[model samples]
Target: MNVLINEQYDIYHVAHSGVPLLRDVKQLNPDVIIIDIESPNRDMLENLNKISQFAPKPIVVFSEQQCANTTINQMVRSGVSAYVVGEVNQKRVKSIIDIAIARFDLFQTLKQELAETKQKLSSQKSIDKAKRWLMETKQLSEIDAYHFIRKVAMDNSQKMDDVAKNILSVASIF
Candidate 1:
Protein backbone atom coordinates (compact mmCIF):
# COMPACT_ATOMS: atom_id res chain seq x y z
CA MET A 1 0.00 0.00 0.00
CA ASN A 2 2.85 2.39 0.84
CA VAL A 3 4.62 1.59 -2.40
CA LEU A 4 1.39 1.86 -4.38
CA ILE A 5 0.71 5.32 -3.00
CA ASN A 6 4.31 6.31 -3.46
CA GLU A 7 4.06 5.20 -7.06
CA GLN A 8 1.17 7.68 -7.50
CA TYR A 9 -1.62 5.09 -7.48
CA ASP A 10 -3.78 7.02 -4.95
CA ILE A 11 -4.51 4.03 -2.75
CA TYR A 12 -7.22 5.14 -0.41
CA HIS A 13 -7.22 2.48 2.28
CA VAL A 14 -5.67 -0.82 3.34
CA ALA A 15 -8.64 -3.02 4.12
CA HIS A 16 -8.84 -6.33 5.96
CA SER A 17 -11.36 -9.13 5.83
CA GLY A 18 -14.57 -9.00 7.98
CA VAL A 19 -14.75 -5.43 6.72
CA PRO A 20 -16.50 -4.09 3.63
CA LEU A 21 -13.49 -3.97 1.31
CA LEU A 22 -15.65 -3.53 -1.75
CA ARG A 23 -17.67 -0.72 -0.27
CA ASP A 24 -14.57 1.02 0.96
CA VAL A 25 -12.95 0.75 -2.47
CA LYS A 26 -16.01 2.20 -4.18
CA GLN A 27 -16.13 5.10 -1.73
CA LEU A 28 -12.39 5.70 -1.81
CA ASN A 29 -12.11 5.25 -5.60
CA PRO A 30 -8.67 3.71 -5.68
CA ASP A 31 -6.63 3.23 -8.84
CA VAL A 32 -5.42 -0.27 -7.93
CA ILE A 33 -6.01 -3.06 -5.41
CA ILE A 34 -3.77 -5.68 -3.80
CA ILE A 35 -5.37 -8.60 -1.99
CA ASP A 36 -3.69 -11.13 0.29
CA ILE A 37 -6.29 -13.87 0.45
CA GLU A 38 -5.92 -17.39 1.73
CA SER A 39 -8.25 -18.55 -1.05
CA PRO A 40 -10.05 -17.10 -4.03
CA ASN A 41 -13.00 -14.89 -3.14
CA ARG A 42 -15.67 -14.84 -5.85
CA ASP A 43 -17.50 -11.97 -4.16
CA MET A 44 -14.43 -9.79 -4.34
CA LEU A 45 -14.08 -10.42 -8.06
CA GLU A 46 -17.77 -9.70 -8.68
CA ASN A 47 -17.57 -6.48 -6.74
CA LEU A 48 -14.43 -5.55 -8.65
CA ASN A 49 -16.16 -6.16 -11.98
CA LYS A 50 -19.08 -4.03 -10.86
CA ILE A 51 -16.79 -1.21 -9.89
CA SER A 52 -14.58 -1.69 -12.95
CA GLN A 53 -17.34 -1.64 -15.50
CA PHE A 54 -17.54 2.13 -15.20
CA ALA A 55 -14.02 2.87 -13.95
CA PRO A 56 -11.43 0.16 -14.50
CA LYS A 57 -8.29 -0.22 -12.42
CA PRO A 58 -5.57 -2.75 -11.65
CA ILE A 59 -6.13 -5.59 -9.18
CA VAL A 60 -3.48 -7.82 -7.65
CA VAL A 61 -4.05 -10.99 -5.67
CA PHE A 62 -1.54 -12.92 -3.55
CA SER A 63 -2.69 -16.31 -2.33
CA GLU A 64 -1.24 -19.31 -0.56
CA GLN A 65 -2.75 -21.85 -2.98
CA GLN A 66 -1.03 -24.01 -5.54
CA CYS A 67 0.18 -22.23 -8.68
CA ALA A 68 -1.91 -23.79 -11.42
CA ASN A 69 -2.67 -22.49 -14.90
CA THR A 70 -6.41 -22.88 -14.53
CA THR A 71 -6.45 -20.86 -11.32
CA ILE A 72 -4.29 -18.14 -12.86
CA ASN A 73 -6.60 -17.87 -15.85
CA GLN A 74 -9.60 -17.69 -13.59
CA MET A 75 -8.10 -14.97 -11.43
CA VAL A 76 -7.09 -12.86 -14.44
CA ARG A 77 -10.52 -13.18 -16.01
CA SER A 78 -11.94 -12.25 -12.63
CA GLY A 79 -9.79 -9.07 -12.59
CA VAL A 80 -6.62 -9.56 -10.56
CA SER A 81 -2.89 -9.18 -10.76
CA ALA A 82 -0.68 -12.23 -11.13
CA TYR A 83 -1.80 -14.86 -8.67
CA VAL A 84 1.47 -15.40 -6.84
CA VAL A 85 0.81 -18.61 -4.97
CA GLY A 86 2.92 -20.53 -2.39
CA GLU A 87 5.84 -19.19 -0.32
CA VAL A 88 5.76 -15.55 0.66
CA ASN A 89 8.60 -13.37 -0.48
CA GLN A 90 8.12 -9.85 0.82
CA LYS A 91 10.49 -8.33 -1.71
CA ARG A 92 9.01 -10.32 -4.57
CA VAL A 93 5.52 -9.31 -3.58
CA LYS A 94 6.47 -5.66 -3.61
CA SER A 95 8.23 -6.07 -6.94
CA ILE A 96 5.22 -7.80 -8.46
CA ILE A 97 2.94 -5.01 -7.30
CA ASP A 98 5.20 -2.41 -8.84
CA ILE A 99 5.33 -4.32 -12.12
CA ALA A 100 1.60 -4.91 -12.19
CA ILE A 101 0.80 -1.24 -11.63
CA ALA A 102 3.33 -0.16 -14.22
CA ARG A 103 2.02 -2.69 -16.72
CA PHE A 104 -1.59 -1.62 -16.19
CA ASP A 105 -0.67 2.00 -16.63
CA LEU A 106 1.21 1.27 -19.84
CA PHE A 107 -1.60 -0.91 -21.21
CA GLN A 108 -4.12 1.88 -20.71
CA THR A 109 -1.87 4.47 -22.34
CA LEU A 110 -1.11 2.21 -25.29
CA LYS A 111 -4.78 1.44 -25.81
CA GLN A 112 -5.69 5.12 -25.96
CA GLU A 113 -2.79 5.95 -28.23
CA LEU A 114 -3.56 3.08 -30.56
CA ALA A 115 -7.22 4.07 -30.73
CA GLU A 116 -6.32 7.62 -31.65
CA THR A 117 -3.90 6.49 -34.29
CA LYS A 118 -6.48 4.14 -35.79
CA GLN A 119 -9.05 6.91 -35.92
CA LYS A 120 -6.65 9.19 -37.72
CA LEU A 121 -5.74 6.47 -40.18
CA SER A 122 -9.35 5.66 -40.82
CA SER A 123 -10.17 9.30 -41.39
CA GLN A 124 -7.23 9.72 -43.74
CA LYS A 125 -8.39 6.74 -45.76
CA SER A 126 -11.88 8.18 -46.07
CA ILE A 127 -10.52 11.56 -47.10
CA ASP A 128 -8.36 9.98 -49.78
CA LYS A 129 -11.31 8.00 -51.09
CA ALA A 130 -13.44 11.12 -51.20
CA LYS A 131 -10.76 13.04 -53.06
CA ARG A 132 -10.46 10.23 -55.60
CA TRP A 133 -14.19 10.35 -56.17
CA LEU A 134 -14.12 14.09 -56.86
CA MET A 135 -11.14 13.72 -59.19
CA GLU A 136 -12.88 11.05 -61.27
CA THR A 137 -16.22 12.89 -61.44
CA LYS A 138 -14.79 16.37 -62.11
CA GLN A 139 -11.89 15.15 -64.29
CA LEU A 140 -9.62 17.21 -61.97
CA SER A 141 -6.03 16.38 -61.15
CA GLU A 142 -5.22 14.82 -57.75
CA ILE A 143 -3.47 17.98 -56.54
CA ASP A 144 -6.40 20.15 -57.54
CA ALA A 145 -8.91 17.89 -55.81
CA TYR A 146 -6.80 17.86 -52.64
CA HIS A 147 -6.51 21.67 -52.61
CA PHE A 148 -10.24 21.95 -53.24
CA ILE A 149 -10.96 19.71 -50.24
CA ARG A 150 -8.50 21.66 -48.11
CA LYS A 151 -10.14 24.95 -49.06
CA VAL A 152 -13.54 23.61 -48.06
CA ALA A 153 -12.18 22.30 -44.77
CA MET A 154 -10.68 25.70 -43.91
CA ASP A 155 -13.74 27.63 -45.09
CA ASN A 156 -16.03 25.61 -42.82
CA SER A 157 -13.50 25.64 -39.94
CA GLN A 158 -14.00 21.88 -39.78
CA LYS A 159 -11.53 19.04 -39.79
CA MET A 160 -10.39 17.67 -43.15
CA ASP A 161 -11.70 14.27 -42.04
CA ASP A 162 -15.16 15.65 -41.34
CA VAL A 163 -15.24 17.36 -44.73
CA ALA A 164 -13.98 14.19 -46.35
CA LYS A 165 -16.63 12.11 -44.61
CA ASN A 166 -19.30 14.50 -45.91
CA ILE A 167 -17.89 14.18 -49.40
CA LEU A 168 -17.92 10.41 -49.16
CA SER A 169 -21.50 10.38 -47.94
CA VAL A 170 -22.65 12.63 -50.76
CA ALA A 171 -20.75 10.68 -53.41
CA SER A 172 -22.07 7.37 -52.10
CA ILE A 173 -25.66 8.59 -52.47
CA PHE A 174 -25.14 9.34 -56.17
Candidate 2:
Protein backbone atom coordinates (compact mmCIF):
# COMPACT_ATOMS: atom_id res chain seq x y z
CA MET A 1 0.00 0.00 0.00
CA ASN A 2 2.79 2.38 0.90
CA VAL A 3 4.63 1.59 -2.31
CA LEU A 4 1.57 2.37 -4.44
CA ILE A 5 0.74 5.56 -2.52
CA ASN A 6 4.30 6.82 -2.19
CA GLU A 7 4.79 6.59 -5.92
CA GLN A 8 2.15 9.21 -6.66
CA TYR A 9 1.47 11.17 -3.46
CA ASP A 10 3.28 12.19 -0.33
CA ILE A 11 2.25 10.39 2.84
CA TYR A 12 1.00 12.36 5.81
CA HIS A 13 0.42 11.02 9.31
CA VAL A 14 -0.38 7.33 9.54
CA ALA A 15 -2.47 6.01 12.43
CA HIS A 16 -2.34 2.41 13.57
CA SER A 17 -5.61 3.01 15.45
CA GLY A 18 -8.65 5.22 14.98
CA VAL A 19 -8.65 6.63 18.53
CA PRO A 20 -7.02 9.93 17.62
CA LEU A 21 -8.51 10.21 14.14
CA LEU A 22 -10.21 13.54 14.62
CA ARG A 23 -7.33 15.14 16.53
CA ASP A 24 -4.79 14.03 13.96
CA VAL A 25 -6.97 15.21 11.11
CA LYS A 26 -7.44 18.60 12.71
CA GLN A 27 -3.72 18.99 13.28
CA LEU A 28 -2.54 17.62 9.95
CA ASN A 29 -5.17 19.27 7.78
CA PRO A 30 -4.37 16.91 4.97
CA ASP A 31 -5.95 17.40 1.57
CA VAL A 32 -6.99 13.77 1.51
CA ILE A 33 -7.12 10.89 4.03
CA ILE A 34 -6.49 7.24 3.25
CA ILE A 35 -7.28 4.56 5.84
CA ASP A 36 -6.18 0.97 5.58
CA ILE A 37 -8.05 -1.20 8.04
CA GLU A 38 -9.13 -4.80 8.39
CA SER A 39 -12.63 -3.64 9.23
CA PRO A 40 -14.36 -0.51 10.45
CA ASN A 41 -15.72 -0.57 13.97
CA ARG A 42 -18.49 1.58 15.48
CA ASP A 43 -15.99 3.92 17.12
CA MET A 44 -14.12 4.38 13.88
CA LEU A 45 -17.31 5.27 12.04
CA GLU A 46 -18.24 7.72 14.78
CA ASN A 47 -14.85 9.37 14.50
CA LEU A 48 -15.24 9.57 10.76
CA ASN A 49 -18.64 11.20 11.18
CA LYS A 50 -17.15 13.74 13.57
CA ILE A 51 -14.40 14.49 11.06
CA SER A 52 -17.01 14.95 8.36
CA GLN A 53 -18.95 17.42 10.47
CA PHE A 54 -15.99 19.35 11.89
CA ALA A 55 -13.28 19.15 9.21
CA PRO A 56 -14.31 17.78 5.87
CA LYS A 57 -11.79 16.08 3.57
CA PRO A 58 -11.81 13.40 0.92
CA ILE A 59 -11.49 9.97 2.56
CA VAL A 60 -10.59 6.68 0.91
CA VAL A 61 -10.74 3.45 2.89
CA PHE A 62 -9.13 0.20 1.86
CA SER A 63 -10.38 -2.69 3.97
CA GLU A 64 -9.73 -6.39 3.81
CA GLN A 65 -13.02 -7.21 5.55
CA GLN A 66 -16.17 -7.33 3.48
CA CYS A 67 -18.76 -4.91 4.84
CA ALA A 68 -22.51 -5.20 4.81
CA ASN A 69 -24.66 -2.96 2.63
CA THR A 70 -25.84 -1.00 5.66
CA THR A 71 -22.27 -0.48 6.77
CA ILE A 72 -21.32 0.84 3.35
CA ASN A 73 -24.32 3.18 3.43
CA GLN A 74 -23.30 4.41 6.86
CA MET A 75 -19.78 5.05 5.61
CA VAL A 76 -21.06 7.06 2.66
CA ARG A 77 -23.41 9.08 4.87
CA SER A 78 -20.51 9.67 7.23
CA GLY A 79 -18.66 11.33 4.31
CA VAL A 80 -16.35 8.61 3.14
CA SER A 81 -15.51 9.23 -0.49
CA ALA A 82 -14.43 5.72 -1.39
CA TYR A 83 -14.54 2.26 0.31
CA VAL A 84 -12.77 -0.63 -1.29
CA VAL A 85 -12.87 -4.21 0.00
CA GLY A 86 -10.34 -7.04 -0.50
CA GLU A 87 -6.75 -6.68 -1.58
CA VAL A 88 -5.71 -3.33 -3.03
CA ASN A 89 -4.39 -3.28 -6.55
CA GLN A 90 -1.30 -1.10 -6.91
CA LYS A 91 -2.40 0.17 -10.31
CA ARG A 92 -5.86 1.26 -9.15
CA VAL A 93 -4.80 3.16 -6.04
CA LYS A 94 -4.20 6.47 -7.78
CA SER A 95 -7.46 6.29 -9.69
CA ILE A 96 -9.35 5.45 -6.52
CA ILE A 97 -7.90 8.47 -4.76
CA ASP A 98 -8.73 10.70 -7.75
CA ILE A 99 -12.30 9.48 -7.81
CA ALA A 100 -12.64 10.05 -4.05
CA ILE A 101 -11.44 13.63 -4.41
CA ALA A 102 -13.88 14.27 -7.25
CA ARG A 103 -16.78 12.78 -5.33
CA PHE A 104 -15.96 14.81 -2.20
CA ASP A 105 -15.77 18.02 -4.23
CA LEU A 106 -19.11 17.37 -5.85
CA PHE A 107 -20.78 16.57 -2.52
CA GLN A 108 -19.45 19.76 -0.93
CA THR A 109 -20.74 21.82 -3.85
CA LEU A 110 -24.18 20.29 -3.54
CA LYS A 111 -24.25 20.77 0.22
CA GLN A 112 -23.36 24.46 -0.13
CA GLU A 113 -26.03 24.97 -2.77
CA LEU A 114 -28.64 23.34 -0.55
CA ALA A 115 -27.74 25.55 2.40
CA GLU A 116 -27.93 28.68 0.27
CA THR A 117 -31.28 27.64 -1.11
CA LYS A 118 -32.65 27.04 2.38
CA GLN A 119 -31.47 30.48 3.52
CA LYS A 120 -33.14 32.11 0.50
CA LEU A 121 -36.36 30.27 1.21
CA SER A 122 -36.29 31.36 4.85
CA SER A 123 -35.71 34.98 3.85
CA GLN A 124 -38.50 34.84 1.31
CA LYS A 125 -40.88 33.49 3.95
CA SER A 126 -39.96 36.33 6.31
CA ILE A 127 -40.45 38.92 3.56
CA ASP A 128 -43.81 37.45 2.67
CA LYS A 129 -44.91 37.46 6.29
CA ALA A 130 -43.86 41.08 6.71
CA LYS A 131 -45.74 42.02 3.54
CA ARG A 132 -48.87 40.30 4.84
CA TRP A 133 -48.59 42.18 8.13
CA LEU A 134 -48.34 45.49 6.29
CA MET A 135 -51.33 44.63 4.13
CA GLU A 136 -53.50 43.72 7.16
CA THR A 137 -52.47 46.43 9.65
CA LYS A 138 -51.43 49.38 7.46
CA GLN A 139 -54.25 48.78 4.94
CA LEU A 140 -51.69 48.73 2.13
CA SER A 141 -51.90 46.61 -1.00
CA GLU A 142 -49.42 43.77 -1.49
CA ILE A 143 -47.62 45.65 -4.24
CA ASP A 144 -47.48 48.80 -2.12
CA ALA A 145 -46.05 46.91 0.88
CA TYR A 146 -43.44 45.22 -1.26
CA HIS A 147 -42.43 48.54 -2.80
CA PHE A 148 -42.23 50.14 0.63
CA ILE A 149 -39.93 47.42 1.88
CA ARG A 150 -37.79 47.57 -1.25
CA LYS A 151 -37.50 51.35 -1.00
CA VAL A 152 -36.49 51.16 2.65
CA ALA A 153 -33.88 48.48 1.87
CA MET A 154 -32.44 50.54 -0.99
CA ASP A 155 -32.33 53.75 1.09
CA ASN A 156 -30.52 52.07 4.00
CA SER A 157 -28.43 49.78 1.78
CA GLN A 158 -29.71 46.83 3.77
CA LYS A 159 -31.12 43.53 2.64
CA MET A 160 -34.85 43.35 1.98
CA ASP A 161 -35.08 40.51 4.47
CA ASP A 162 -33.49 42.66 7.16
CA VAL A 163 -35.95 45.47 6.45
CA ALA A 164 -38.75 42.96 6.60
CA LYS A 165 -37.51 41.67 9.96
CA ASN A 166 -37.45 45.20 11.33
CA ILE A 167 -40.97 45.78 10.10
CA LEU A 168 -42.15 42.63 11.83
CA SER A 169 -40.41 43.62 15.04
CA VAL A 170 -42.11 47.04 14.99
CA ALA A 171 -45.44 45.41 14.23
CA SER A 172 -45.06 43.07 17.19
CA ILE A 173 -44.75 46.05 19.54
CA PHE A 174 -48.24 47.28 18.61
Candidate 3:
Protein backbone atom coordinates (compact mmCIF):
# COMPACT_ATOMS: atom_id res chain seq x y z
CA MET A 1 0.00 0.00 0.00
CA ASN A 2 2.89 2.34 0.67
CA VAL A 3 3.87 2.04 -2.98
CA LEU A 4 0.45 3.40 -3.99
CA ILE A 5 0.48 6.26 -1.49
CA ASN A 6 1.13 9.16 -3.83
CA GLU A 7 1.79 12.76 -2.89
CA GLN A 8 -1.80 13.74 -3.70
CA TYR A 9 -4.38 12.93 -1.02
CA ASP A 10 -7.40 12.47 -3.26
CA ILE A 11 -8.54 9.01 -2.22
CA TYR A 12 -10.66 8.04 0.82
CA HIS A 13 -10.72 4.49 2.13
CA VAL A 14 -13.50 4.03 4.63
CA ALA A 15 -15.59 1.33 6.23
CA HIS A 16 -19.38 1.07 6.51
CA SER A 17 -20.14 1.76 10.14
CA GLY A 18 -23.73 3.07 9.91
CA VAL A 19 -22.37 6.55 9.40
CA PRO A 20 -22.93 8.20 6.02
CA LEU A 21 -19.61 9.52 4.69
CA LEU A 22 -21.32 11.95 2.33
CA ARG A 23 -19.92 15.03 4.00
CA ASP A 24 -16.43 13.60 4.15
CA VAL A 25 -16.60 12.39 0.57
CA LYS A 26 -17.60 15.81 -0.68
CA GLN A 27 -14.98 17.53 1.41
CA LEU A 28 -12.31 15.17 0.18
CA ASN A 29 -13.75 15.02 -3.35
CA PRO A 30 -11.77 11.87 -3.67
CA ASP A 31 -11.17 10.46 -7.11
CA VAL A 32 -11.42 6.96 -5.66
CA ILE A 33 -13.45 5.36 -2.88
CA ILE A 34 -12.55 2.09 -1.24
CA ILE A 35 -15.33 0.75 1.01
CA ASP A 36 -14.73 -2.06 3.47
CA ILE A 37 -17.73 -3.55 5.25
CA GLU A 38 -16.83 -6.25 7.71
CA SER A 39 -20.48 -6.89 8.42
CA PRO A 40 -22.92 -7.71 5.60
CA ASN A 41 -25.70 -5.77 7.21
CA ARG A 42 -28.53 -4.72 4.89
CA ASP A 43 -28.36 -1.17 6.15
CA MET A 44 -24.74 -0.92 5.10
CA LEU A 45 -25.44 -1.75 1.46
CA GLU A 46 -28.38 0.64 1.44
CA ASN A 47 -26.12 3.29 2.82
CA LEU A 48 -23.69 2.68 -0.01
CA ASN A 49 -26.46 3.37 -2.51
CA LYS A 50 -27.22 6.62 -0.76
CA ILE A 51 -23.58 7.61 -0.73
CA SER A 52 -23.18 6.84 -4.40
CA GLN A 53 -26.11 9.08 -5.20
CA PHE A 54 -24.85 12.04 -3.20
CA ALA A 55 -21.22 11.83 -4.28
CA PRO A 56 -20.45 9.77 -7.34
CA LYS A 57 -16.82 8.76 -7.09
CA PRO A 58 -14.98 5.78 -8.45
CA ILE A 59 -15.52 2.84 -6.13
CA VAL A 60 -13.89 -0.54 -5.40
CA VAL A 61 -15.65 -2.87 -2.97
CA PHE A 62 -14.52 -5.50 -0.47
CA SER A 63 -16.65 -7.54 1.90
CA GLU A 64 -16.28 -10.22 4.56
CA GLN A 65 -18.39 -12.70 2.61
CA GLN A 66 -18.36 -13.35 -1.15
CA CYS A 67 -22.18 -13.41 -1.07
CA ALA A 68 -22.25 -9.63 -1.24
CA ASN A 69 -22.27 -9.95 -5.04
CA THR A 70 -25.82 -8.72 -5.61
CA THR A 71 -25.23 -5.58 -3.59
CA ILE A 72 -21.87 -5.06 -5.31
CA ASN A 73 -23.54 -5.29 -8.70
CA GLN A 74 -26.12 -2.77 -7.60
CA MET A 75 -23.37 -0.43 -6.51
CA VAL A 76 -21.70 -0.66 -9.89
CA ARG A 77 -24.98 0.22 -11.58
CA SER A 78 -25.35 3.18 -9.25
CA GLY A 79 -22.17 4.87 -10.56
CA VAL A 80 -19.52 2.77 -8.94
CA SER A 81 -16.99 2.96 -11.76
CA ALA A 82 -14.99 -0.11 -10.86
CA TYR A 83 -15.63 -3.10 -8.54
CA VAL A 84 -13.21 -5.70 -7.13
CA VAL A 85 -12.96 -8.22 -4.33
CA GLY A 86 -10.48 -9.22 -1.57
CA GLU A 87 -10.09 -7.78 1.90
CA VAL A 88 -8.86 -4.31 2.59
CA ASN A 89 -5.34 -5.14 3.62
CA GLN A 90 -3.72 -1.95 4.88
CA LYS A 91 -0.70 -2.90 2.76
CA ARG A 92 -2.74 -2.81 -0.49
CA VAL A 93 -5.28 -0.04 0.08
CA LYS A 94 -3.10 2.62 -1.53
CA SER A 95 -2.61 0.74 -4.80
CA ILE A 96 -6.33 0.03 -5.17
CA ILE A 97 -7.08 3.69 -4.54
CA ASP A 98 -4.65 4.82 -7.23
CA ILE A 99 -6.09 2.59 -9.93
CA ALA A 100 -9.71 3.48 -9.15
CA ILE A 101 -8.94 7.19 -9.05
CA ALA A 102 -7.30 7.14 -12.47
CA ARG A 103 -10.23 5.39 -14.05
CA PHE A 104 -12.74 7.76 -12.38
CA ASP A 105 -10.89 10.83 -13.63
CA LEU A 106 -11.05 9.61 -17.20
CA PHE A 107 -14.78 8.92 -16.91
CA GLN A 108 -15.50 12.36 -15.44
CA THR A 109 -13.57 14.08 -18.20
CA LEU A 110 -15.66 12.40 -20.86
CA LYS A 111 -18.90 13.26 -19.04
CA GLN A 112 -18.00 16.94 -18.82
CA GLU A 113 -16.99 17.14 -22.49
CA LEU A 114 -20.27 15.60 -23.57
CA ALA A 115 -22.30 18.05 -21.49
CA GLU A 116 -20.39 21.01 -22.92
CA THR A 117 -20.96 19.76 -26.46
CA LYS A 118 -24.69 19.48 -25.87
CA GLN A 119 -24.85 23.01 -24.54
CA LYS A 120 -23.06 24.37 -27.60
CA LEU A 121 -25.39 22.55 -29.92
CA SER A 122 -28.42 23.97 -28.14
CA SER A 123 -27.02 27.50 -28.34
CA GLN A 124 -26.31 27.10 -32.06
CA LYS A 125 -29.99 26.44 -32.69
CA SER A 126 -31.00 29.64 -30.93
CA ILE A 127 -28.42 31.67 -32.88
CA ASP A 128 -29.62 30.20 -36.15
CA LYS A 129 -33.18 31.28 -35.48
CA ALA A 130 -32.07 34.83 -34.68
CA LYS A 131 -30.08 34.91 -37.89
CA ARG A 132 -33.13 33.80 -39.87
CA TRP A 133 -35.20 36.56 -38.26
CA LEU A 134 -32.62 39.13 -39.30
CA MET A 135 -32.69 37.81 -42.86
CA GLU A 136 -36.47 38.35 -43.07
CA THR A 137 -36.81 41.71 -41.28
CA LYS A 138 -33.55 43.37 -42.20
CA GLN A 139 -33.21 41.75 -45.63
CA LEU A 140 -29.63 40.67 -44.85
CA SER A 141 -27.74 37.74 -46.34
CA GLU A 142 -27.05 34.70 -44.18
CA ILE A 143 -23.42 35.63 -43.59
CA ASP A 144 -24.37 39.23 -42.86
CA ALA A 145 -27.06 38.16 -40.42
CA TYR A 146 -24.63 35.97 -38.55
CA HIS A 147 -22.05 38.74 -38.52
CA PHE A 148 -24.68 41.15 -37.23
CA ILE A 149 -25.26 38.94 -34.17
CA ARG A 150 -21.53 38.58 -33.69
CA LYS A 151 -21.09 42.31 -33.90
CA VAL A 152 -23.69 42.90 -31.21
CA ALA A 153 -21.98 40.31 -29.03
CA MET A 154 -18.60 42.00 -29.50
CA ASP A 155 -20.01 45.45 -28.77
CA ASN A 156 -21.73 44.34 -25.58
CA SER A 157 -18.95 42.00 -24.52
CA GLN A 158 -21.55 39.25 -24.21
CA LYS A 159 -21.80 35.81 -25.67
CA MET A 160 -23.08 35.41 -29.23
CA ASP A 161 -25.88 33.22 -27.94
CA ASP A 162 -26.93 35.94 -25.51
CA VAL A 163 -27.08 38.49 -28.29
CA ALA A 164 -29.21 36.11 -30.30
CA LYS A 165 -31.56 35.76 -27.32
CA ASN A 166 -32.02 39.52 -27.09
CA ILE A 167 -32.72 39.73 -30.78
CA LEU A 168 -35.41 37.10 -30.48
CA SER A 169 -36.89 38.71 -27.38
CA VAL A 170 -37.29 42.12 -29.04
CA ALA A 171 -38.64 40.59 -32.20
CA SER A 172 -41.18 38.50 -30.30
CA ILE A 173 -42.61 41.57 -28.54
CA PHE A 174 -44.18 42.61 -31.85
Clashes (backbone N, CA, C under 3 Å), per candidate, total 1, 0, 1
Model 2 per-residue lDDT tens digits across residues 1-174: 242243455555464445575566556554434443333533464356464654332222333243345544544553543432334563464465544444554666888999999999999999999999999999999999999999999999999999999999998999
Candidate 3 on 1-174: residue-level lDDT in tens? 112245644334543344454455445554434432223333443355454654332233343243345644544443333323223353354455445445445565778999999999989998999999999999999999999999999999999999999999999997
- Error (Å) of candidate 1 at residue 98 is 0.5
Higher-lDDT candidate among 2 and 3?
Answer: 2
The estimated TM-scores of all candidates read: 0.53, 0.54, 0.51
Which candidate's lDDT is highest?
Answer: 2
TM-score ranking from best to worst? Answer: 2, 1, 3
Q: Please report the candidate that would top TM-score against the real structure.
A: 2
95-157: candidate 1 lDDT, tens digit per residue:
555555555455557778999999999998988998899999999899998998999999999
> What's the true lDDT of residue 122 in model 2?
92
Query: Model 1, residue 12: displacement in angstroms?
Result: 32
Cα lDDT of candidate 3 equals 0.58
Better of 2 and 3 by TM-score: 2
Off by over 4 Å in 1: 1-42, 45-87
